[model samples]
Target: MWRGLRVALVRERFTVDGVAALIGSAARAALDRGETTPARRAVRAAGAAGALVRLFLLGDVLPRDEVAAALDPVDVDEAVTAGLLDVDETGVRAALDLRPHADAGLPDAPPWWVLSDLEVAPGGRTADREHVLGTGAASLSLARATVRRPVDTLLDVGTGCGVQVLHASGHARDLTATDVSTRALQIARVTFALSGLEVECLAGPWLEPVAGRRFDQIVSNPPFVPGPPHVEHVYRDAGLGGDGASALLVGRLPAHLTEGGVAQLLASWLITSDDWTGRPRAWLGEAAEAAAPGGLDAWVVQRDVADPALHVGTWLRDAGVDPASPEGTALSERWLDWLAEAGVHAIGFGFVTLRRTAPDVAGTVVCEDLRQSHDDPLGPEIEAWLDRTAWLAARSDEALLDERLLVPDTVALERGLVSTDEGWSPVAATLVRLDGPQWRHDVDELGVALLGGCRGHLPLRDLLDLLALAHGRDADELARTAVPVVRDLVRHGMLTAVA
Candidate 1:
């Protein structure tokens, strides 16, 4: 569908107006007339009414008028049922003037329509609507990872429209969905039923609904945006204190997982002054260790860190509350005050995929920022992280350092030589390109040039002697600098230390 037509046709008022009502009424009348399968008959009648509405709206005025003059019940029925005419501009304009609010009711965003094997507008939002279920980047990421795992019992926390629950049904034996919003639960129930999915639904906040329940896989797109205790509509805000909500969800997982159970979630948390890595680790560590005390192995990667104002604006925009409005302005103020009170300058957004962290089996959680497009519903790249084995905390500088080392011939020289605007010429290089996280070195041209020559055939001492003979520079000065450069290469895992 064209964007403009979609916008016009999708409003809840339009769905309920003249056409929808007429079709509904007509379907009821047909049912009374002994139509086979009343429900299907009603839908067909409603669809016909919608089609007629579309025709009068889309057709030319004089032509439609002539057609209307000659139109009989059969013609109207066929036109409405088969969509001979479209909902045109004039009809839409007239409908707009007729006070849709007085006639049809509340405004709404477009619905997800699967037409001719094509998905049209999966979901939409209106000006005042606070909650809507639509798959986002984070949600999609979670979905991809969840399907690949061999999970028996799947749990979707805060299952808005049960997107994750639906996705998980493909792999999970038994699926359970929990949410705080009753309205969302209603939509979710319908969504599951229509999709031919059967899920056990629970209504409660956070982990309250499924207390003491253990699952092989737990996936959540929780409300981790830190703000005041409002916006309970349930997509953006989780009414928990501090990182209370995020931590609460994280804190409880260990207890709810069987030996090797895995939990995947997308969350945001306040970044404090103390150790950034230690902060998230503290949640899985500490007194809660007994909860699932195999010692939860965590990989918490700080992706995009945002300051207070950015965090505030992010959620405010998500809520669809205009900052210019009085209520919007007040919301903004309250958010600023809350963030300020918490001493939160920036918040982090990323995935937290955890396992039971049992002692017998090493449970791992890898946190890394892999920015990529997961557009395909069933693509392999989406599950790459699920197969990730690297844990930053578990490995040492030596193990990390050793990764840079090469066995003889594979080592390559990579020099970075550039002149900045300030006329400072800096040239830097290594024995083998450093692969460590923190690659630090001085910009000494001769050091890079000399390191490039070491191929293990000529001893380092011979190269210095030749350079000393050619340039007549001090061999001692050249040799001294050479040792540090080689040491740095070895230290950073660029090259293995020669035995």
Candidate 2:
């Protein structure tokens, strides 16, 4: 039955591009905004694809004959028995949310189908505790940020509906998915089957099912929501106290990673004080110190932050609870009380990437706020970050000075000007990266001269000496001051070591 449905979907061109072409971009954009009227109108004249869209995407009930005609070779009774469709006196509707998804960053990649529970309508009843989610913002972000280099083995922890595994299938040799909810595992199995992929699904919380086993790569979109220590929805709540789920993964996942293995996960943490990095730094510090042989290198980027009130309201609506209603008011009060008592002033949402290092090597953990917009995939940037940091770590000041460096074209220098009595004068100079993370750094005249001289022609020591001579300063003192500055530039990809 799954094979027949797959064939029918492919034959009908029920894919991401196919659907967009049929409905137009406006209707597609509307569907993303949770308004299906435009899509319904656009697909009214479409054939089998239209029927499938109405039945599955728009949550509209179709006549039995139309469904039968759309899903040819796959008997309606078979589909019903397989729990893919539901029939009532009115007509037939989708029992699940099956839709086409592809990596927008990889245009050449083939489209894949995903199966999960349908979304709850606004003001409708809350979702089931065990509901599995399909492609959404969090999942898509993790997918886009994931490092996609080929690996021998990969693991997806808390694999709700197995969307991460679907993205990993192209680059990983062996795939394993683990979840705490059996229902989610079941849905993920069907998702894999429909996508024509094989994955080992294990039912257990976070890394328990794969104890003593190591993978070359691991990815997770864990239940990192911060709230009271109780489970209302299995997909978002870890049943642990505030932000414990994120801490748990950060501390434990290192032990299960092979040497040089990389793990990326979406996590949320609480902000009790002005120091947002305090919690994550402590978590990574403990984890890396206790790790075997080599420590763990962790990079955490805080993408968004929400205050306690806004956070509560956002999640309340997400669970299908109306915040204005009596129940919602009471729930909100309780949730806010917990957060207040815990001294959490805000909540931070972001991704963490950890890499296991070689034996006897110390690891580095960097935590920072990067709320800027990113126009490109972060996988390559992250990979480069790890490499650059490692290179800097292995070099001493003397060793680094002997190496030549060059700035790539992606790095741009910007000067801020202010109107003055005479003319527009430069108030500040800043170096900006045009690619990943788009970091900006304020620089002085010496910094500008140093960067301009780094053209892969001379060693850094020679450049520093020339700058000191030009500025009538001591070369040794200049080199001493420039060592840390150069390291920072290299770490942020503002400067590159010439090979």
Candidate 3:
């Protein structure tokens, strides 16, 4: 039974750290690079864990007796009966990937023993339409970005192996997981059963499984891979061509969100117009329109963008196609040709977050690009920034001036000193906050000089006066100039309210 496997895994300390230790740092690092040879070698001496590392984790064949010993509390017979293992004349090999998964970014969350299709790292076949994914970077990104505040109900669309549900289960009162692939749903059910948790399972595309329903929260790391024509994988590529799947899911999200509900999704959208963020904003507007009186507020962050060529190659590689091969070259050509014809200059990858708010509250669509990598668990930072934006949107500059502000301790300032023929000239100043993304706001010298006093102790008028006195400038003019900068800084999270 799944319960028995769970117990055996716990007994064996089949944890992230445990596996890392058995494999050693080199092997671990190599594994991240998708090379399993080093890791394969490192786990050779690892007793029962070795068999598991061989049979399930690494997709290597293990002697039948070794598998029986490693999975003792949950016997090999059970694993075989449970469809987790396959025995052959040579030895026993994995039918799927089974490993301990934990996210250090979310320390409060429990670890999960995950089950899914094998990966390239384990020398498994290319992920097919029926493949169920184990936890990967995209899944981890969704987990890290999701605002972890407790909610009554949560829905996970495209719930591959139920990893998202596992992350959400502790917080949500009711959980519903949906997957288009029947095999994926089966694995997800196994995931929950092993964790001693229960979740309602549905089968269909996007939100079809949950018609005429709304939830407090929804999260999906759906099939957003913009594959070339006839891409086989269901886990990454939606049947609709040219990133249609991501658009449809995002467009319909607002209607299924309860008042104050937030949906977080990782998706890729095509770059059609001159602007990168334009289409995403339009999608948000459509979702808002669908929600009607209670419009959907959106904050979509485009994390990365790639040209058609690079995008095509990336997806080709993702599907485990050799770039040098004939098929890979042909696929790339077709996708690139399509992009060229369609005027798709680039493909933008990002997270789309839509919040359904009350009828009286006017909604907004914030679409921006952030290519830099920052720290993890940015949920609180996002919530803080969103709250700040809403507050700023409601207030005029005069009211904002009256409100004392303090920059959060996480913020740092940089005054760029350009080298010239004569001497160093302080040319630029950038205010940055630590929010897992370099949130940089440019401020002038006067704005830079006046920021030291922004400790929530002084009103805007007072800070301007102080700066004017220090700089021997007109206080009124200084106030006029600095108020807007401060407001912008506050909005961008470089400055925070004292409270």
Candidate 4:
């Protein structure tokens, strides 16, 4: 029956692109926004595909003849027996949403049929406690951020509907998915079975199911929504206090990671002070100290920050509750009160990547706000930057100054000019990376000249001599001043040396 259904979907082109084509992008987007009118109209025009979509995706009742004709090889009666449908004299309605999903970055991979809980309507009602989540923006974001390099084993924590586990199956030899909800594990079982793969779907909170074991990689899009203390849905609410789920997962990563292993997660942390870096800095310290080999490298990129009200409202809408209503207002007040009691000024949401470094490698933490759009599938870019950072951090000032450096093609040296009553004066120069993380570094004029002169043959000593001669500065003073700035460039991957 499953094979027949797969064939029917393939023959009908029932995929993400296909749906977008049938409904047009506007209506397709409307579906995401919980407006199904335009989508219903558009899917109706899609013929047999429309019938199948209506019966299965929209949870709409379709004519018996229409469903039979749409899925000829696949038995509709078998679908009913499997509890996928409830058919009557008039038509059929799906028990769940089974839809085609494909990752834009993973074009070589086949499109997946995802089955999970239904969405809440715009009128804003919350989901059931046992709700199993399907693919959403955050799910896809973690997918794109996940480093897809092949690994020996992967541990998927809080594997709701098994989206991350499914992706990890492609590159991981041994895959294990853990969740506290039994229903989630059941959904994960079906989700894995649909993908023609196998996984160990264990039942436990976080890593309790896989105690005393280390994984080459661990990926999770856990229940990270910060809300009031009372738990409504297991899929989004951790039942832990005030963003504790995120902190717990990140802090425990060190104990679960093998040497040089990496863990990535979509998390939100509370900011209790004016300095945004304070919270993550403390988390990194705990994670590193707890990790085996006693060192971990951390990169935390904050994508957005929501104040108390906005945070509560955004999550309320996510849970399908309208914030404008009396119930939603009360819920918001409770969550806000919780935040106030905890002394949380704002909530920082972002992607966190932690790596258990080799014994000789130094522990480091970098937390910064990058509140701008970025390219997807950033894993490779991030891995390369981490390697560069580790290499630069390992170098002493003398050792760093002794080596020749080359500026990458992606980096452009720009000079900032200040216009005043006097002629335009040079204020600053920066090395701007146009791709990847979009990093920029400030540099002095001599530093810029030295970086440009780095043709793989000139060392820092040679550059200092040239700069001192050109600017009439002492060589010793120039080296002392320019080396630190050059080191920063090296750390950020603007400057590099031959391997």
Residue by residue across 1-499, what tens digits does model 2's lDDT show? 9889988888888999889998999999999998999999998988888998898889999999999989998999899999899999999999888999887656777668999987773348545898788887899889988998899999999999889998998899999999999999998998898788889999988888999999999999999999999999998899898999999998888888899899999999999999999899988976785467787889999999999999999988888888889999999999999999999999999999999998767787889788999867778888888899889878989999999999889999999899999999988899999888999989988999999999999999999999999999999999999999898889899999888
TM-score of 1: 0.56
Candidate 4 per-residue lDDT over residues 1-499, each given as its tens digit = 7667777888888878877788888887888887888889887667899987777667788877787778778788987886666788877877666888776656777767777866653244544788787888899888888888889999999998888877776789999999999988887777777667678889998889988999999999988887666679898888887778888888898899998788999999888899877777777777987785657888898989999889988878888878988988898888888899999989989989998988777877878777866774677766776777778778877888788888889899788899999989989987898777778887766677787788788787888798789989999988888777776677677788865
- Among the numbered candidates, top lDDT falls to 2
For residue 82, model 1's alpha carbon misses the true position, in angstroms, by 24
Candidate 1 weakest ten by summed lDDT: 97-106
Global Cα RMSD, each model: 14.0, 1.7, 3.0, 2.7
lDDT of 3 by residue, 1-499 (tens): 8887887777676878778888889988888887989988887788888777767666788888888788888777678777888787888888778888776655666557788877763443475668777888789888888877889999999998999888887679899999888999999998888776789999987899999999999999988876554548888778677777778888898888899898999989888888887777767767888777796678888888998878877777777887668987887787788778777888999888888888877776778777777665657666766687678767777787777888788899988898999899888988888655668888777777778888889887788888889889998887777777776677678777775
lDDT rank, highest first?
A: 2, 4, 3, 1
Please give the CA lDDT of all the candidate structures: 0.54, 0.90, 0.81, 0.81
TM-score of 3: 0.90
TM-score winner, 3 or 4: 4
Give per-residue lDDT, candidate 1, residue 303. Answer: 49
Q: Write down the TM-score of every candidate.
A: 0.56, 0.96, 0.90, 0.91
Deviation in angstroms for 250 in model 4? 1.3
lDDT of 1 by residue, 1-84 (tens): 123232333432243344346446665455446452443534333443333333332221323443343233334334434332
